[model samples]
Target: MDIANSALRLAERRGAAGKAPPLESSKAQVELANARIEARTADAALEAARRELGLLWGNAQPDFESVDGKLDALPQRGSLDELSAALGDAPLMQGGRLAVALGRALLEVEKSTRYPDITLSAGVARDNEAGRNMAQLGVSIPLPLPTKRKTPIANWRRA
Candidate 1:
């Protein structure tokens, strides 16, 4: 926009001095108009995007004026192999990998339920009447019901 404005001003000055053709000033004016329209369009888009971003954070209206950054800089190009390797670390790919890991862990837990857990207890009790301490030991092993184990494993396998 600035460039276009400068060009228009220079063209006008040259025309006034009779050093430039009238056509040059007309072209510069058109260019300036185009630049103004483009700047307005870009501003509208930026504002809309800002409002959208604000909505994500539960804000009805955005408060900020402008964002800071350079849009002209291009990202460095990479080889196909490097890009392929980087793809594995991308968010979507990471999510997929995590989902697979979660499923495997869930399946392992379900498989573990096929075997019953063992519980062991040992305690010493003071018998006041006998004036002696007595030790007791106990072990418990829960029976795994086939019905309890089969359903979840089947469900996971189906998934």
Candidate 2:
């Protein structure tokens, strides 16, 4: 479509002009540092796993001790901007966000259900000897007028 073409052209122009909205530099630094730390940790974990496996079979360490990959540091990505989105969308962060939301929703539910459920009952009875039918409707709900306050307290503590 013409609109799509124009939007693509606009994006290209903005990219060429290097006029993209600036990202929060502090956030970017923290995010990138965290990412690097995670990378190093994961690398170390993998090496540990390998060492553990070797130890299981009693394989000796390499005599020379030359590591093919450097553990010191990783080369920086050209665009921290590019990585920001991926980090934000990472599974760990997503799960944490969902967990917080669930906690809040649960707290709301607990607050709403401070009392017990309301119930309704309907019944019909027929007596053959009397040749008459009787119908009745009733409703019953438990009331904890003296609120225990446990549910809200628990939900608050969890939240």
Candidate 3:
């Protein structure tokens, strides 16, 4: 918008000096009107962005009249290599990696659970009338049941 306005102003000055063609001056004016409309649209978008940001921060009203910053003064961006290196340690990327690791660990645990169960028992029975004691020992192992498994989890259990 600033660039458009500047061009229009330059055109007006040149027109006043009788150095600009009438058609060029008219085109610049039209361009300036379009730029104004674009600027309004950009402002509305910025306001919406601000409102969304406010909502993210738990604010119902975003009252700032204007954002304060110098776009040109921002530091030059890093190279893709630098950005990619940073991503390896970024919180969002790390969180995703952590989630994947957690899923894998959970899958391992679920697989382990599907392994056959082993049970061992020992007991002694006393029969005072018979004047004797009997000892018993037992072991039970359960085989995997395919009928009870379901969907994707079933595949892991089989594995």
Candidate 4:
């Protein structure tokens, strides 16, 4: 807009001095009008962007006037080593690591299921009518049946 305004002023001055044709001033006015329209359009876009950013922050109506930043400035880049170190703490990387740990834990649990569980029992009973006390003890071990255990592991892998 500034550029267009300057151009229009220059054109008007040249026209008044008889150095530039009348068409030059008309062209400059048109350019200025176009610049104004573009400026308005740019403002609308900026507002929309601000609103969108506000929505991301859970705000329906943003109270702030304008965002602060240097549009033309480039962000500083990190060194390879620094970036690599940071990658370990990245959300996606951490998720992957956690998933691997979970898979291993699940595998260990599944492997354990292959073994039978042993049960130990002991009890004492007193009978007033018989005037006697009896003690009992027993041990039992469950027999694991042969079944397809790979299906669950395969499902986990697929997931």
Which candidate would rank higher by lDDT, 2 or 4? 4
lDDT of 3 at 62: 83
Ranking by lDDT: 1, 4, 3, 2
Q: Please estimate how well model 1 matches the true structure, expressed as its whole-model Cα lDDT.
A: 0.91
TM-score of each: 0.47, 0.46, 0.49, 0.52
| TM-score of candidate 3 to 2 decimals | 0.49
Evaluate model 4: give its lDDT.
0.91
Q: Residues 1-159, candidate 4: write the lDDT tens digits.
A: 999999999999999999999999999999999999999999999889889999999998888887789999999989999999999999999999999998889888977875788889999989889999989899999976777656566677787
- Report the Cα lDDT for candidate 3: 0.84
**Highest-scoring model, TM-score:** 4
Give one digit per residue, the lDDT tens place, for model 3 in 1-159.
Answer: 778878888988898999987777788889989988988999899889999988987987987766668887979899999999998999999999999898789888777786787999999999899999999899999886677537556665676
**Clash number for candidate 3:** 0
Worst 10 residues of 2 by lDDT: 20-29
Q: Give the true-structure RMSD of model 1.
A: 12.8
Q: For candidate 2, lDDT tens digit of each residue in 31-125?
A: 55666677789889877777776676687552333346677889987578888878889999999999989888987887787768889999998
Better candidate by TM-score, 1 or 4: 4
- Of models 1 and 3, which has the larger lDDT? 1
Q: Which whole-number lDDT from 0 to 100 does residue 108 have in model 2? A: 81
Number of the candidate with higher TM-score, 2 or 3:
3
lDDT of 1 by residue, 1-159 (tens): 999999999999999999999999999999999999999999999999999988988998989886777799888989999999999999999999999999899889988877888999999999999999999999999986555344677888787
